[model samples]
Target chain A: MSNLLTYISVNDGKIKRSSLEVLSRCNEIAEKNGKTSSAIVISDDCSTIVENLKSYGPSVIYTIEDPIFKNHLNTPLLKALTLAMSEINPDVMAFASTEGSKDILGALAANRNAAALADVSEFDWTGDAVTAKRPVMASKIISSVETKGSPVILTVRSGSYDTVEKSGESKVQSIPFTFDKNELKLTLKEIISATGDKVDLSEAETVIAAGRGVKDEEGRKLIDELAAVLNAGIGASRALTESGDYDPSLQIGQTGKVVSPQLYIAVGISGAIQHVAGMANSKVIVAINKDPDAPIFEIADYGLVGDLYKILPPFIDELKKIKG
Target chain B: MKFYVCIKQVPDVNAPLQIKEGELIQDANRNILNAYDASAVEEALVLKEAHGGEIEVVLIGPDKASETIRKALAMGADSGSHILTEGSEEFDSFSYAKILAEFFKDKEYQYIFCGKQSQDTDSGLTGSMLAEFLDLPYATNAVGLQLEGENLIVKRQGDTGQEMIELPAPSLVTCSNDMNDPRIPSLKGIMQSKRKPVNTIAVSDLKNGLTNGSIKTSVVGYEEKPKREPGKKYEGEPDEIAKEVAQLLDSAENVI
Candidate 1:
């Protein structure tokens, strides 16, 4: 029996794609270590979610049903997870690098006195310990880290792996968890999604981002038209958003949203390291700029060095043809 | 009320990285305050202004770490503390959080703020780990913060959406982007920082929870990312370039 536990969180009664990726990765690691992989799903109800997780091939599913979980509050959830970790004592615990998982893993690392790695993209089990790799310095460098002890926690970056095909009928066990009223100090008031733009930049498959090179409102409309033609999400560089011309929520840079879309089209951007940090992991990058020396071209799989004004119209036409 | 903000000095990410001895070392001349921590300092200053509290910025790095705290003070923080670790050695997030928890154990503070993660390490572990070690409630990725009487409300950005949460005092918050635009140091504020004193403490002076060989993780090596091969460069008439790009996208790139 392998002691590998994956933390699964349900939002609005649905399993997050990132969480499923974590479970799938956990199964891979457990299989490599010749151990059984288990999962802990926290939600108001687990009957449906448990069915979904069993397809991922977990050996056992631990279900915790509590109304407080619906709010995504951290304190009570941390309390229950800590108690659950003690019961399992898994050699390795993997969590998705989602906001909730990061918070919980950070707290759980301290609560359980376990070493933790955040946003780890690669990992393997060795003779006595686990070694993982994570990007540093805006992914310009990768660091190899080795954990010496068991019960090491890792937050897996999204898109690092695929969720496995559903298989195996896993046994289910309901974990009894109680939250003390005094201990539950935080209250989740609401969940407000960014409006107007329906495509969440972080989750979009294809993204067309505008930079300061777009120049003005008129220029931005062309970029927007291109995005609409391609049916891709619109993103902005830090400079464009800071100029007060675009919404800050659309900004994609080191300090802004980190997106790993399948295709990222950067227009009029110089390819600063800060901006690249957010989108460097894209499957393919295309940069269109007037300056031939723009750094974005260095990493782009395809480079179109010319005036976007001259290039965008024809580019839009080509995209429309493809769509049609 | 007393508020503590933790800041770090990171290499300006825009500068080209320099590799030495199988590790990526940032250019010393281009170091600046970490982006996320700058947001944390701004959040602390905003909350201090609204709640009538004293703001103290803290750092746990080399003696040069005081430079980051000075930047925070120039941004309107009241004071600074530098926990100078020996040489350039760095600790993992868990050990670093333990040190912060220990340093603040004897101090009086209602709220502690930190960046969601450092730009160099990109590990969003310290804030919540510090909260756990200090036995306090915590929140991460706070984009909006509001104070109501003795209670606190924080709006955090999640993968799917944003969550607004309410918490009492004695909590820790890790700030993210969209929290607020960090104010550049004013000339007057810079002059005041010159006179402000920064208390420096050696790491050995404090009771850290980590013992010899207690750290469970270490960076064994580093590798520079391979540069991408320069792809086809098309420079021609707008229509011709567009057609070539379209054909490439369809046949070569397969993105279309």
Candidate 2:
């Protein structure tokens, strides 16, 4: 039987839910096709991660434990992944599309001389080739892509598949790995984390994004208050982020993060195609814009035409009441 | 110091497009330099202005994409190289990266810059793939870049935060459009851009293993994304509508 491998991504001592989603999908595909599904976790210590991955229903779990993986560095991470590939030699390797994965997806593909597809919304193994649907043209169109060859490397977009929990015992295999600092080509000086302890925008269930219409501190305060009420992550459009009203990391658009939250509230956003490209997949979209003809309303499930200044206070109050 | 910024000409996403029998058709006149590549070019220009270096923008596209190279020169690049490709070739990121690696095999440069991803396809794979092919150190999704002696400090947007990475000379970096605003070409600058040298090389001239048979991935077709139908619009009486929508979200949507 062919092997399907999922790379489990760990950040801040926790397994990313998106990776679990990809693993679940791989497990399902393996079960249907009679392929052996496995998972690989690369980190400083893979013990905890391996223990957590058992519920995802992988037949085998591979762990590469090294101190070099404490932070995100492409050089050592690529080396570890390349080594793992040689040992397992899977037919298909999948990853969750994250900044960390994006950094190395192409390099890993090139390293193994394997076919690579990035940011696919949906993918399936065709026994001989892997077929996927990728969002192209600023996510306005879906492109059907097929990669023919062994060990096809692909990254799945977050929230593309549901994470299914299957309790079962899994075979754990620890892969030996090592790295020398002298071989490192780049040094990670530090991480300037702006979203410290806050909800990650991509993983958040609810996201409240501000835009140009959020003129000043008062408008930002309203966004903050509303997000606080809903316990949602706060994001910003390119306009607001470029204007220094929000951190660059929080920009939600074509040039920034693509998020598919359960509930997305776009306040004062004009819903430019770039902005819409990032959040169009949100389960429920609410657009609050003063202009009744704002393009955001075209796709928003609930379009509120009025001043965000006036709309936010009552919205926050009502949400608070409902929670109470 | 010398910088090579890789650029691409892509259809303006804002423009109207059509899909006929799985083929994507765009208005030819609306083609522009990819925005993220423009940022890379802009950052190269800024570094050249301060550190005193040469900026050469390289593009691999059809003959029509020459205008995009000229656009970069007009913005203050010293020269350009156009690796010409026939407009009809269906190349994925791997093909492009393979071709670029072949071109750079003999060239020497302190840094190579590219957009984190293309605007139209958004594959976001070519930069790192090219780096791997060249066996060079590289960083991607750089939102801020600074030069410290012979080292390049890249502030890249990570999954949860911004990572400050330091790479030595002769490395590659993929820039985000958030880095800087690309300068608009002035009238005089545009005129002078015509005088700047742009070396054109046909893709077939490179005698590598590059051929249609070598391509492993293909975009078979394209279809429209399932549309999200507009639900309800609430206008007038901001307080009432706001509260009404909030209640509905909790009760009807059950999302709260």
Candidate 3:
């Protein structure tokens, strides 16, 4: 059919936030194109994984498996996607802009000589083309793109668009495809994991981030207590993380993790542009800096001028009270 | 061993970079190599030095991108080639990489090196995408890379931590800032760069049937980043300030 839309999904390590966002956008686009959207996942088996993602409103789920696919290597995924796109010949192909997906999809688009739009934060279905917003120049500008090629390949920026929720029934099928694992250039011999039990900041919704303002473990404990009360995740600025005061997993800045949280509480962090760009999309922002003029306040919906130590105690006490 | 590294010229990252009145204001006067691309070039240079081989620096972008190539040659690349594209400056990584794949398909370079991702977009897609197009083994965010006969020993970073991977030759590797220290252009190299062979080819030469993407992703407009509020020193005692801070979190700070 001229209007079948395909969603290219990559599942590696933990499923990414961006993948859901892509499926959401595809659903919107497919409606406009007069066809239904389906998910294409490349993995070792379609049994359990495809069933899990079928809830995202795809009419059918296409899968190609190999033991090598378990690592979600980029080149193999690209090859698998290229083969799938040709077979399905969907009018639109979509994916999320996570690390592996970006690379795999971009390269796939290039090799096939197809058009690709990426890091799109928003999109509108027009008469003949889809309008997409890709932020550039350090998030200072937005590029509005209208696609002009067959099966336009697009990668959605993570956390920029809300994932769709299904209240109605959705059709689901499993289609098998040929995945030539031998064609991949790089192979993953081992998967080394991170140490300890710190949380991944990028995946957290409510984040309690501290900067250089916490001078000692005593001050850090207050922030920790506040975090525990709210069941929130903890993050730190570059200064504190580099100072060896906090775990690297807690670092949030340009060179650190990018997070999109529902509520972002900054303690003692003067929002540097590099740092702010990483987390400016938080639903609600709170900045606490002794210096009233800290840059972090520019994007913060709320600002506080006081020492974090004394303020944190009563705040935690009240949160605990609510929890109790 | 032969290495081909991709390089691009970009505006100084912190020169009041802004989108004003629908124009990207890059002080054309001050330009350094793209930070990530520079890392790519640096990684290439390191390979040439350690393994004793030839290094060719390749760049595809606007005409001014030649200046960036000159800087790379001056930094000790054996030579340089330019894949010129009209209005290529406005092209995204998709178009850039497409044009590059066209230029590279015929050449048989043993290894390709690039930054893990360009800093400007932070997309981290170009290198991996390039590997896919070429159907080569690719490793990214590599902090440590060593040559092993026809194989590669690479220390790569992931969401969790570093991984040691072994891949076949003819691979694509992108470096993080940790890979190795990039060398600065020595004075003698700068003087010699003036005479180094710099060749330019029109976009038509590489014409991998690439056109500015049909999708007209245009900019609505841009505004300068808002300046931060100056910190206000609370004169109250530590206890008072702490109380105020807690109150501020729910009210002004909006966190509690």
Q: Which candidate leads in DockQ?
A: 2
i-RMS for every candidate (Å) is 2.1, 0.9, 4.3
Residue B235 lDDT (model 1): 69
What DockQ, between 0 and 1, does each candidate earn?
Answer: 0.65, 0.86, 0.38
lDDT of 2 by residue, A151-246 (tens): 799999999999999867799999988799998999999999888888888888999999999999999999989899888999999998888889
- Tell me which residue pairs clash in candidate 1: A2-A36, A55-A166, A55-A167
Off by over 4 Å in 1: A9-13, A180-182, A195-200, A213-231, A240-250, A306-310
**lDDT of the candidates, in the order given:** 0.82, 0.92, 0.68
Which 10 consecutive residues of model 2 chain B have the lowest summed lDDT? B205-214
What are the fnat scores of the candidates, in the order listed? 0.79, 0.89, 0.40
TM-score, model 3 to reference: 0.84
lDDT by residue for model 3 over A1-324, one digit each (tens)?
A: 554454544434345566777777777767776666777766776566655676676776776666757664665666677777777776667776554554465567766666667666776554356667765555554555566656567777667777785434555444455556566556666666553355545666689999988899898998888777766878888788667687554567655566788788898898876677668777777777788678776677666666777667765775565455
Error of 2 at B174 (Å): 0.4
